[model samples]
Target: MKIKQYRTQFIQELSPLYDAYEAESFFYLILEEKHNLRQIDVALNHELIFSESEIWVWNSLLAELKKEVPIQYLMGKTNFYGLDFEVNEDVLIPRPETEELVEWIINENLKAQKFKKLKILDIGTGSGCIAISLAKNIPNARVFALDVSKEALKTAKKNSENNKVDVTFIHQSILEIDDLKNDFDIIVSNPPYVRNLEKKEIKNNVLNYEPHLALFVEDTDALIFYRKIAEIAQKNLTENGQLFFEINQYLGEDMKALLEEMNFKNIELKKDIYGNDRMIFCNVSKTS
Candidate 1:
């Protein structure tokens, strides 16, 4: 069957699960990944057809899509911060909002007049996306990533090698650490911030398919990870060092209060492209 003909059916079938735009995007993404066929190629050549085996592959993927499986999980990999990352059930899929956090860090570092050889740590680094992207983009950065889950660290390690970035991977939980053991110029995290009460707001694809361990926190202690990491940052961050977080959109004020009470200076809450309170940056005071 012509690939174009199958595209129509694919979109229609996924429409019940995703919007028309998202469903259409999934079709093109799979086409490129599976067949090296781009949208223009499909458009320019009306004669392109899927072979019998290729059709079977599409049918299998479609079946999974109908089950509301994430396309990224089905592909076993995803593009993040201009690098390809291996993702699976063990790690949460990288989101665009987190990319904005990365961009924020890179931009801030680049704009500084003195280019210090920086040591950076990423807490709860699931796929090592933040750590690898920083190591790749900033040639002088010594990057380290920490995660509690050994399974997630395995995937993060592979992603670091695949992206040709040198990121030290540590297997430890932030909640258990009394100290980071080294002062860092920057510490960043996109920790699990979703409260159990917010589960109803999550999409079925995410709620059902993504790892809950990487997604949820107790409703009463939504800021548990933030508080613990902040405590460590006070002792471990260098003088004038910066701390950045991809925060729960709903808890920006609470995050500010936490940092302020800890004597973290220059706390700034920045919104993502969609204007949600999705990121925060704070600096350790000189006197502290």
Candidate 2:
């Protein structure tokens, strides 16, 4: 079949689940992943035909897409902060908002006049996207990432190597760590901030396929991970160190209050491109 013919059928089949634009995007994503064909390539070679074996591969992915499996998972890799990251069921897919958070960190550091090397820790690093991105962008940074799941850490380590950046990976839960055993100029986390009650608001694709352990918290105590990580940061952050979080949009006020109660000064809440309150930054005082 000609590529355009298959593209039409592919988008039509998934239109019931995703919008026309999203479906078209998925088509190009799979084309690139499965056939090394970009949208421009397919357009230029409109007669490009899919052999029987290639059709089989595309059909298999189409079936999974109908099942609401994430395209990133289907591709087994994603681009974040201009770096390629290997992803799986063990890790939450890195989002664009998280990339914004990373850009914020890099921009802040770049604005500083000091030439001293800075230390950074990414709590619950998951796929190590943030740590690896920071290390790759900031040549003077020493980056470390921690996760409770050894499986996630394994994927993170591979990503660090694949990205050609050195990031120290620690397989430990942030909830259990009292001190990081070292002070960091920056500590950041995008922990399990979603309350169980918010499950209804989440899409079926994410709710059903993404790992629950990395996505949820008790409804009654939704800020458990944030509070725990903040507590650790209190002791582990160097004087004037910054703490950053990619937060739950609904809990922006709550997050600010928590940081204030913890004596995190200069607390700032920022919105993402979608205008959602999705990231926060705080600084520790030298005396406190």
Candidate 3:
């Protein structure tokens, strides 16, 4: 069958679930991945055809897409912060807001007069996106990533290696530990901040397919991970060390208050490109 004809059919079928633009984007992504054909190639070559076997494979993928499986899971990979990462059901797919968090950390540290040999830790580092991005961008940083689930850690370890960054992966839960065992110059986390009551706000593709353990908190204790990690940071962060978090958008003021009560100085709650309060930064002041 002519590939362009299949493309039209693909988009039409998916338009109900996703917009025309998104469905078209998905078609081209699959084309590039499966056939090594770029969008330009497909546009220029109207006669291009999908072999029978290839059609079968694409049909199967289309079925899964109809079921609302994420395309990243279907492709078994994704791009984040200009690097490739292997993603699966074991880890949550990296998001653009988290990339903003990484950029903030990189920019803040890069402003130093000279790059210091800095120790950094990423708590609940599913897929190791933030840690690896920081290590890749900040050459002098020694990065460590910790996650509770063994499966998630396994994926994160592979991602660090694939990105060719030396991020030490720790298979431990942030909630279970009292101390990080080593003082770090920077500590960052994009931990579970979604409350159970907020589940209705989540799309079916995420609520049904993504790892729940990495996404949810009790409605009564929405800041559970943040609180636990902040406590550990109080003890394990070096004097004047910085901490960063990708927070739930609705709880920015609550996050600011939490850090203030914990004596974190220079608290800065910033918005993402969408202008939602999505990230926060603070530094521990030993003297305070």
Mark the regions of model 1 whose C-alpha exceeds 4 Å error after superposition.
Answer: 111-114
Question: How would you encode candidate 3's per-residue C-alpha lDDT over 1-288 as one tens digit per residue?
Answer: 999999999999998899999999999999899889999998888999999999999999999999999999999999999999999999999999899999999999986627478899999999999999999998778899999999989998998888888998899888899987799999999999999999999998899899999999999989999999999999999999999999999999999999999999999999999999999999998888
Query: What's the distance in Å from true for residue 194, model 3?
Result: 0.6
165 Cα displacement, candidate 3 (Å): 1.1
Tens-place lDDT digits, model 1, residues 126-233: 999999999998867889999999999999999999988889999998999999879998999999999999999999989999999889999989999999999888
Sorted on lDDT, highest at the top, how do the candidates line up?
1, 3, 2
Q: Give lDDT for model 3.
A: 0.93
lDDT (C-alpha, whole model) for all candidates: 0.93, 0.93, 0.93
Clashing pairs in 2: none
Each model's backbone clash number: 0, 0, 0
Cα displacement (Å) at residue 101, model 3: 0.4
Cα TM-score of candidate 2: 0.98
Task: Assess candidate 1 and give its lDDT.
Answer: 0.93
Q: Which of the predicted structures, 1 or 3, would earn the higher TM-score when compared with the native?
A: 3
Task: Provide the lowest-lDDT 10-residue window in model 3.
Answer: 109-118
